[model samples]
Target: MSELDHASDPVVGASSRRDLFKLAGAGVGLAAAAALPLVPATAFAATPRFRLGEPEPAFILDPDVLYMNIGTTGSTPKYILKQFNDDNREVATNPTQSFGGVTPFRTLAAPGFGAELEEFVISYNTTDGMNKILAGVELNSGDEIITTNHEHPGGNGPMNLLLQRRGVKITRVNLPVGNNQKAQDYVDLFKAAITNKTKAFVFSAPTYLTGTMLPYKRLAKLAQKNGIMTIVDGAHATGMFNLDFQQTGIDFWGCSGHKWQCGPGGTGVLYIRNRVTKANPLPLFNFWPTNTNNSTLIEPRTNANAETYNIGTAVQSIGNPNYPMLKAFAECCTFWDSIGRGVIEKHDLTLSLYLKQKIASVWSVDNLYSPKDDPELLSALTSFSPFHTSSASVALGQAATDETAQSTTFVTRMREEYGIVIRNTAVPVIGSPAPHHPMRISTHLFHSARDVDRLVRSMKDLASRMDAGA
Candidate 1:
C-alpha cells in the first residue's frame, strides 16, 4: 500500500483505541483531542451496530457499580455536569446574572418533546408538575376522578390532599397484574369504571409498580368519549418513550428528566395541551402563580392558540429558580434528539427484552411480574420475583409478607455483595392478600450483554446465598 493511503487510516495512523481513551480522559473536547471526526449522537443508535458498554467519553458512571436502576435515577454526563458546575459558580459570584427559565431553553427543547414552544416547562421532577395541575383543577365535594392502583405519591399526593380537604372522591381501578393480560384488558378495566360523575381520568403510562405501558391512546379515547380530562404520570416515560402529546390526545403528562434522560436531579418536563383542538378542547381552570407575569393581570386568562398561554410557567418561574439546572436539561434533551428518539427507544427496549429473557430462563416465565409477551406493554424496566418459594403453597397473609420481605432483602444483598444496583417494587397480585415485592432492573444505552449476564448471574448467586426461602 502507498504511504499516503497508510497515513489516512484512522486505525493504523497514530489515532488508536488507546489514544482515544486517553483523549476521553483529557479535560477538553474529546473528539477534537483524538483528531477523529466528530460523529453525531445518532451514530451510536439502534440496528445493533455499536456494541454495548462502548467507550463514551461523555458519560462518567462508576465502572465498579453496575447501575441497573435508571428507573430510580440516572447519572449525568460529564460534559453537562461540568457546565452545570461552571454556570452555578458564575451565578454564585455575580449573584444575579441568570435569566428566567423560558427564553433561554424554549426554542431548543420544544421540538424534541413534541411540545409547542409555549407548552413545555422545565419543572422540578414529575411530582412538581403533578401538584401544580392538581391545584389548578376545579372540583367540588363528591366529584369523582379516576386513576389506577399503580400511581406513585407524586400523582396520588395531590389527589389525596383533595380527598381530605374538598371531599373529592378519588376512585382507583385495581389494575390486573402479570403477563397474562392484554392491552384490551386495560381499556375494558378503565371503560367499566367511567361514570357520568367522573370528571378526570388520571393514570400512569407504564406504571412504576409493574412497568406496564397502559394503552394511552385507547384510554385517552375513553376519556374523550365521555368528555373527561386526562392526566398521565409519566415519570419513567420521558426518556424511554417517544412521546407525542398532541397525537396521544392526553390532556397532561408529567415526567422526570433524571430517570432515563440522564439529566440532573430536580429537573423534569411537563406537557400541557394548551390549545383548544379536536383532540382536547375542554376548558381548564387557570391559576397563575405569583412568580409569573400573569399574576399581575386581573383579566381572566385568554388564549390566541392552544399554546398561547404558558400554564407551565406557573410551576417553572417560581422565585428565582435554578437557571443553570434548566440549561443543563436542555443540553441533555438535545443530546437525546441528535441520537434520535426512535433509535434510543429501540436500543433500550432491546436491552429490556434481553434482561427479561435472562431472568425468565433462570426464574421461569410464571415468576415474571412485568409483561414479557406483549409488544405494546414493554419498557426499559423489568421486574420479577427472585425469592424462595416452597413447592408446597404457604399460608396467605403473614406468609406473603415474609416472602415479600425476602424479595426486598435480596435487592439489598445485590447492591452490597454483588455491587449491582437495582430496586424492588411491591405490587398487589390478583388473588394474593399482600403486595408482591419484585426486583426491578432498568437497562439503558450504557449496559452491555456482559452487564446483563453478570447481573443475572450475580442475582442468582445472591439469591442462593441469602436463601430467599421463607
Candidate 2:
C-alpha cells in the first residue's frame, strides 16, 4: 500500500486505528481482526511504525512497581526531568523576569493540540484551569449549567463556587454505565434535560470515576443549537487523545499537564475558543479574565470573524509564574508531538481494550462500570467491580461499607503484595442508595500486552483469594 493508502486503511492505517478499534469494539464483523495482537505479532506488523512499550525507557518509573494509575497522575519522562532540573538551576542562579507572559511556550505547544496561540493558556493543573474558566464566563442568577453526576472535585469545586457566588443553578445528569450504552444515549439525556434557562454545558470528557469518554463534540453542538456554551473538564484527555479544539466544538477546555502528559506538577493547558468555527458558529460569549494582570487589555470576541484580544496571554500573565515548570510543560508537549499523539492514543486505547476484554472473560461484562462496546466511550482508564458478579448488586443495595472496605483492601494489596499501583473509585450506580467502589486501571504508552496480562492475572488471583475469605 502507498503511504496515503496506509494512512487511510481502516485495519492497518496509522490514523484510522481508532476507527478500526471502534468497529471491533462495536462487534462489526472484525472479530478475527480484533482478536489479533497489537503490532509486531499481528497482521498489522509493518504499519503504524510505533510499537507498544516502545517509549517505556523514556519514563523513569520504578521497575518494581507496575504503575497503572496514570488517571490520577503520571511519571515525568527522564529527559524532561533533566531539562526541568537544568532550567530550574538556571532560573535560581539568575533572577528571570517573565514580562512577555508565556507566549513563546504557548506558541511551541498550541499547534500540536490543534489550538491557536491566542487560545491556549498554560495554567496550574486542571483545577486551576477549571477555576479560571468558570470564573471568567459570564453567568447570572437563575442560569442553569448542565453536567454529569460523575464529575471530579476539580470541576465540581469551581461549579459549586459559581453556585454560591452567582446563584447559578447546577443540573446534573445521571450517567449510564457498562457495555450496552452508546454515545448518543448521553446526548439524548442532555437534550432532554435542557430547559429555556440552560446557559452552559459543563462536563468532563472522560469522567474520572467510570472513564466514559462523553461525546464532547456532540454535546458542544447541542449547546450551540441552544445558543449556550460548553466547558469541558478534559483532565484525562490532554495527553491521552489526539485533540483538536476546533473540531471538539467546546467553548472552554480545562486539562491537566501532569496526568497523561507527564509534565511537572501544577501545570496544565487551558483552551479558550477565541474565534468562531463551522462546528460552533455561535457568537463568542462575554468573558472577564479572573486570574490575570492585564484584564484591562483583554476584551471578549464579539464577532465570528476575528479575535478581539489575546485571551491566552491575558489569562497566562498572572504574577511572577514558575518559569521552569511551564518551560518543562511546553517541552513535554513537544516530546508528545515528536512521538505522535495519534500513535500514543492508539497504544493507550489498544491496551485498555485488551485489559477490558481480559476482565470480561474472567468476570463477565456486567460488573464493569466503564463502557467497552461503544468505542466513542472508550478511554485509557477502565473501572470494574472486582468483588461483584453483576451491576445488579447496586440495585440490591449490596455496595455498602463492607464493599468499600474490600475495595480499599484490594487496592492496598495490589500495591503491597503484587507491586502494582492502581486506584479504586466510588462509582454511583443508578437506582442504588450508595456508590459502588470499583478498581480503576490506566493503560498508557509505557504499557504493553504483557503488562496488561500481568495486571489481569494478578487481579484475578487476588480477587479469588479475597472472595474465598482467605
Candidate 3:
C-alpha cells in the first residue's frame, strides 16, 4: 500500500484495541499491525517479568504471525504509535501553527550517536536522505562513483540519476560471500576499483543482500585520503549499531528509521558533515537548499567551526514537515537512548550471532552468507541456504540460484504455512552467472531466543519437506 493509504487509515486514530482491529484490514506492515489484534506470534506469554537481554513487549503485534523480517520494516512500539496518533489529531486541530524546524529533535538525538545537532536532520527515509545528499553535491560530467553491487535501489537511484544526467561513470565491486571473507577484503576491492576520476565513494554499510557489514570507518578514511566525497547508505545501521558518525569521518550517511529503529514508515535520519574538522580536511562542497522556506540564501559557505550556520536547518526546515512522524521518530530515538544504544546493539548482535551459530551447526558453516567470527562484519541480519539438498550446488555458480525454486517457495511457505514473515535476497556470488537467492532473517529487540528457535526449527522442518525426499 501507499503512504496515502496509511494516512487515511481509520485505525491509525483508533482509541482502543477493538477499534484498532475493526479498522485493521490495513495491510501486513507495521502501520497496519498497530490496529491489528495482539495475537501472540509464539507460545511465550506476554508476561511482565523483565529479564536481561530478552525481547520487550512494548509493542502489540499480531501474535498469530511471527514477524522476523525487520530489515524490510519494523513494528512501531505502542508509545510511539500513541504519540503519533495524538500528535496527528492535535495537528488537525491546529493546522496553521507549523511545528517545523528539527533543531529540538536533533539536539535530543545527536548526543546518543556521538554527533552534534548541527550535523543531523530527520529525513523521510533512506531514499529521501540519499536524494537530499545527492541533490546537494555538485556533480560534474565524466566524474566517477564507486559503490558495491549489494546496494539497495534507495542508494542506487541517486547514483543512477547522476549517471544519466551528468554522464558520470558508475563502478560496482562484486562483494565476496560467507565466513572466508574479512573486512579488509571489502576495503581491498573498493581500493582496487578507485581511479583518478573517482569523485565519490558510496555504499550500504550492512548490505541488504547476504547481510554483509562492509567496513564503513575504514572506507570513509580511504575516501578522505583520496579527497573523495563519502555517502553511506546506512539503512539498517541506525538503531542496530551505536554509530559515532563524527568518529567514522564520513561526509554523509542516510538511514531508515522504520527498519531497525522501530520508528514510523516514511521516517529516517541523515547525517551531513556541517563544517571542516580534522576528520575531513577537504574544502567544503557548496550545497544549496532544494526544499527550503527561506526566500533568500547564501552559497559556498565556510566549512569551518566558528559561527557556522546550521546546515541541518536548511535541510530540515524545507517546506511544512510532518510534525507527528518526526516527533514519533524523535521519541523512538529517545527510547533507544533511555535503554542505552550500546545495550540495544549488543542485544541485537547477540541474537543475530546466536542464529548464525545455530545455522552453522545445522546447515554447515559454509552455507552462511553473513560473517560469523569477525565481529566487524556482523549485523542483525542472518542469510543462508535453506535447501539441504542443493546446498553444495551453488559451487557450480549461477545454475543453483537461477534454477532453484527453493528460496521463493520456502519464503512463501514460511509465511503462509508456518505463520512467519521473513524475506529472501538474491546475492551475486563472485563467479556466479546468476544471483544466489538466500533466505534472510532479522533479529531485533522485539524477538527472543524462543523466537530464534522457532524460526530455525520451522526452517529446518520446512527445508526437509522441500528437500525432495533427500
Candidate 4:
C-alpha cells in the first residue's frame, strides 16, 4: 500500500490517533512497546481514556499564537508560575541565605526522576550541567569520548572544551535518519567506534534538531559492557519521558527543566550515578567537583555497593542559589507527577505520531528528517522538509543556502500569518555537501489532534504558496 493509504488506514487512522490520544491522556497503557524497551507502553496505546487538551488550562501561554516550540523552551504552568511569584516575593522580603544547596527542593524532586537525594543536583541549566559533567569527569590526555554529529552546542561545547583543556579525543558517529532506521542501528554505530581508549559515550536523547529519541538503555548497556561512562544530554528527556537514572545505567545526565519540564529558565536537573547498578557493575569512575563550593566534601565512588560522597550536595552548593526559581522547578516536578509523566508522554507522542502521519500522507515519508516507523526513535518533535518531495533532492551541496532561506521563510510565515509558533533546524544529512534545513514542531500535553491537523493544513498551504512564488 502507498504511504498515504497506510497513514489513513482504519487500524491506526487519523481519527484514532486523535481521539485515542485525547481519551488516553489519563492513563491507559503504561506498558512499554515491545520493540522500544526504553519507552513507556502508553506511547503505543490504541485507545486512551482521558481528554487530550484538558491540560491547556494549566499553562499560561499566549492565546494569539499556538506555541509549538517547547523543544527549545516550555511555558510555565499557571500554578507553578504563581508559586514562583510567591517564592520570589517571600525570598525578597525575608532576605534569606541559601547555604544548604537547595536540598529541600532536591529531596522532594529526586525520586520522581529515579534518582537518590544525593544523586540529583538542581543545575543552572543543561549547559551548566554538561559543563560540570565534562569538567568533573576524570578524562586524561588521549582519552576518547564518542558522540554524534547532530549534537547540540550544549553537548558539543563541553566536549570541545575537553578537547582543548584535557586533550581528550572526540569521535562523532553520523546518525541515520527517516523511517527505515531502527534503535539498534544507533547502538551498532556507537559500538563500532568504541576502543580501549574510549572513556565515555556522550550524546543527546531526543536530539533537538531531528527529534529522534535515541535508545538510551541500549546505548548505556553498550557503554557498560565496554567499561565506559555514559554522559547524556537529556535536554528534551527530563519532562518528556518518564526516565529512571539508575535503571538507564547512565553515569551522568543533564536535562533542562525549562524545556519540556515547564520550569523557570536557568533551572535544570543533573543526575550522577554515585552507586553501582546491575547494568554497570564496574566501580564508578573518578570524578572531581569542578564547579562547587564544597569540593573538599566530595570524593569519587570506589565501591560498587555504596556511594562515596554526596555529589549532588557538592555540585549544588555553588554559593547563594536561586531559591525561588529552584522552588518553582521543584513544584513543576510535582505538577508533572500529579498528572503522571507516562500520561503526558503518551499524549505528546500520540500527537506527534498524528502529525507525522499527516505529513507523510501529504509529503511522503521520504521528506521526513525524523523517524516515524521506529517506536524507539519516536519523540514529540517532528521535523520535515515541506518544500521538497524527497530528502534526496536536497542532498546536493548547492541547495543549503536556498533551503535555509526557504525554511526560515516557512517558519516566519507559519508564525506571522498562520499564528503558529514553530522553529526550523539545519539538519546534517549524510552524504550531503551541506545541511538540510527542515522545520521542527513540538507536541506537548496542551496540544491536541486538531492542533496537529491545523499545523499540517497551514504547512501545506504555506508550502504551496511559497512554491508558487507568492
Candidate 5:
C-alpha cells in the first residue's frame, strides 16, 4: 500500500513486525522494499491497530479507580504520552533548539493540525482560547453578542466580563432544559436574536452542562445572513463528535483537547474563520510591547496588534507541554476516526440509552434530560432527578443546612460509603426562589453495560434503604 494508505489505516494497538519492516524499508528509499525479507507465515498480522475496546496504558489514572470523569478531563494514552515525554526530554537536552529554533513551539504547532504554519496559536487551555477571541475581537459598546444560558462558565464568564467591562451587551438564549429540541427550533431562536446591533453569535456545538447539540450549520448560515460573526464553544465536541470545521464554516471555535479528545490538560485549539480574520479590524497576529499598562486596550485596537495574544510564549515554561500528549491527541482523533464517528456515536448513545432505561426501570429515576434516538441532541452523559420528590428535596435543601460544605452530606455518603461518583447540579424548579435542582450522572465510552447495571442496583439499594428506614 502507498504511504498515504498506511497513514489512513486505523492504529489499533501495538505495532506489528511487518509494520516495522515496512517502516524500515521506507528509510532506504526504493531499494529497501526490495531488500526486505519476507515475514514468517505464523506471525499474526499487526494487532488490529488500537481502536476502542482495547485497553490502553494510562498516564495518570490509578489502577483501582473507575474514572467516568472524561467529561471533565481525559487521561492520555501511552503512545502519544511517549511522544510528549520525548519532546520534553529533547527540550531538556537542548532547550534552545526546542523553544527558539527556526520553528518555535508555536510555529511547530501549525503543520501538526494540517493548517498553515502561521495560523496555529497555542494557548494554556480552552479558557485561554476564549480570552484570545474576546481580547482580539473589536466590538463597540452596545454591540450585542448572542450566546446560550447553557454554556459553561468558561464561556459565560467571559461574556459577562465583556458586558461589564467593555460596555458590550450579551443576549443569552434559554434552551429547553429537558427533551429533544428540534433543529428548526435553534434556527428560529437565532433568527429572532439577530439584529443590526448583533455583532457576534457564540454557542457550543454540544454544550458541556446540558449536553445539547446546536445546529451549527444553520447557526453559521444565520450569522452570515446578518453579517454577524459565529464563535462556537466546542469544549465537548472535539473527540466526542465528528467535527469538520469546513462543513460547519463557523467563524471562531474554542475546543479543549483534554475533555473528549483525551489530550493533555493544557491543550486546546482555537480556529479563526479565514475570511473573518482577513477582513476584521481586530489584529489577529501582532505582538504587544512589554511596556503596556493597558494590554487589553491595545489588542482589540487593531487586527494585527500582537500575535502574542493568539499564541502565548510561556506554555513551555508552565506545562513544559508533553509533546507526546499533543501527538496522542492527534492519535486519539485517529483512533476515533478509525472506529468511525458514526460507530462511536452510535455505541455511546446505545450505552447511554440502556443506562437511562435501566435507571428508569430499576430505580424509577426521572431522566429529566433527553430522549433516546435523539443522539445528536445529547452526548454520552445523562442527567437525572430522583424518582422520589422527598429525596430530591433533601438533596436540594442540603446546601442551606451547611453553608461551608464542598457538596451535600448526601453526596459525601454516596462517594465515601457507596463507592459511586455522580455529579450534583442545581437546575430550576417551578415556584422556587433559587432554582438549584438535584444531581446528574455522566456516561462515557469507558463505561460498560455492567457499570450501568451497578449504578441501577446501587440507586435501587439507596432508595429502598432510605424508604425502609424512614
Candidate 6:
C-alpha cells in the first residue's frame, strides 16, 4: 500500500518511513511542503503561552488517540522529525562527508549525543546497552550485587543471565509497598546488604513500580565507601527526570531514551566514570588477551570472544542516525530545561496527585501504589489497584499476581471502549511479589487536566459497572 493510504488506514498504527520521507521531501521542495498535511505542526515552532485549561501540546502525534502513555514510547514533535529526515537525506546524498568523510556524522554526534564515544557510552536499545555494561565489566565469582524486586523484566532477565552464566550472586532488597516503609529504610537496607564479596551494586534509580525516586546521592556515597561498582538500570530515569550521572558518582548507568527522554526507539545511554577506566576491566571488540599486568593490554592479548558488545560495522553503517530525532531529543532537553526541574516535577505531581485523589474518592479503589505526594519520591508515572472487583479477586494471588495481563485488559478496554491510552507497568507492584501491577498510568507534558478528568470519569464509570455486575 502507498504511504498516504497506510497512514490513512485505521488498521495501520503509527506513521511509516514513506510518510516520514514524504514530509521531509515536502520541506525540501518549498512548494510541496506547504501542501503536506501538517498535524498541528505550527504550534511546536511557536512559543506557546501556558494557560490553565489550554489544549495540551500536540506534537505531530495522532490527535485521534489520547496518548497518556508517554512512558511506554514518547511522541516526537514535527520539528525534530523534520531534522531527522533532513539529516538522513544529507547522509544518503553525501555519504563521504556524512558517514565516510573525514568529518563523520557519528563523530559530531558523539560530543552532544550521549555518553562520549571515548567513554563506554555505546548507543543501543535499552537491553543492548545494559548488556554491554553487564558483559564488559569483570565480575569475580561469588561477588554479590544488590538489586530490588521493583524492576522491569528486561532488567530481571539480564541480572539472572549474569548469575547463571558468570557465577555472580544477586541479593534482592525488597521495599515495602505503599506506606509500609519509608525511603530511608530502602537506603539502609541496601547499605546493610553490602559485604566484602560485593563487587557491583545495581538498582533502578527510580523504583519502576511506584515511581519512587531512590536516594542516589546517599547510595552513591555508600557504594563508593564499599568500593563496589554501581550499575543503575535507569530505563525510566532518563526522559522523565533530569540526570547528571557524573554528579551521581555511580560507576555505570544505562537508560532508554524512548520512555521519558522521548528519543526514538533503539536509542539509549550508558555512562562509565573515569575512575572505572583503570579499575574496571571491560571486554573488547575482537579482544585479544595477554599475560601483561596492565588490564588495558590484556584485552589485546585475549582474542577468544572480543566481538560480544561492540557497536561494530553493523550499526556504524546504518546511515547517519535519524538526525532530526536526535535534534528533537536535544530540543526536548531544551524544553525540559526551560520548564525547570522544579516546575516539571510539580506539573507531573499535580497530575498524579489529582489522579490519586480521584481514585481515592471512588468507593472501590483500595490501594494507590505511587509515592504519597512527596516531591522527593514521586515521578511522572503512577500505578494503582481497584479493590472490591471481580478482576482483582481473580488476579491477586497470595504470592504474586500478573499485573501485565490484568492491566492489558484494563488498558485495552479503556482504549477500545473509551478513548484513553494509559500504560500497564511490568514493574512489580508495591506489596506484590510479581513484577507487574493491574493498572498503571503516565502523565507527560502533552497531558492536561482535562485528560486526567477523562480518566477519572472513565474510572468511576468502570467501578460503577463492576459494582453493578455489568
**TM-scores of all models?**
0.84, 0.91, 0.85, 0.88, 0.70, 0.71
Candidate 6 Cα deviation (angstroms), residue 121: 3.1
lDDT (C-alpha, whole model) for all candidates: 0.72, 0.82, 0.75, 0.79, 0.55, 0.55
lDDT of 6 at 141: 73
Per-residue CA lDDT of model 5 for 20-106, tens digit only, reads: 334434323323332222222122133244323223333445545445556678776666677777777876787653333322544
Tell me the tens digit of each residue's lDDT in model 4 across 253-273. Answer: 999999999899999999988
Clashing pairs in 3: 39-63, 40-63, 41-63, 276-303
Model 3: residues with Cα > 4 Å off, grouped in runs? 1-56, 97-101, 388-404
- Please give the TM-score that candidate 1 achieves against the real structure: 0.84
lDDT tens digits by residue: candidate 6, 198-293 = 877778767666667676766777776677677788787776655655556666777776776666666766564432322233322221111112
In terms of lDDT, model 2 sits at 0.82
Model 4 gets an lDDT of 0.79
TM-score of 2: 0.91
For candidate 2, lDDT tens digit of each residue in 71-155?
Answer: 9998888878997888788778876744244778899899989899888998899999999999989988999999989998999
Off by over 4 Å in 6: 1-58, 97-122, 275-335, 338-342, 363-366, 388-406, 426-436
Q: List the residue pairs that clash in candidate 1.
A: 274-306, 275-306
* Pairwise lDDT winner, candidates 2 and 4: 2
**Candidate 5: what lDDT?**
0.55
User: What RMSD, rounded to one decimal, does every model reach?
Assistant: 9.6, 4.1, 11.1, 6.8, 11.6, 12.9
Candidate 1, superposed: residue stretches over 4 Å from native: 1-52, 99-101, 278-293, 298-306, 388-397, 468-470
Range of the 10 consecutive residues with the lowest summed lDDT in candidate 1:
1-10
lDDT of 5 at 413: 47
Give the range of the ten consecutive residues with the poorest summed lDDT in model 5.
Answer: 35-44
Stretches of candidate 4 above 4 Å error?
Answer: 1-52, 97-101, 295-297, 393-398
For candidate 4, the 10 contiguous residues with the lowest summed lDDT are 30-39
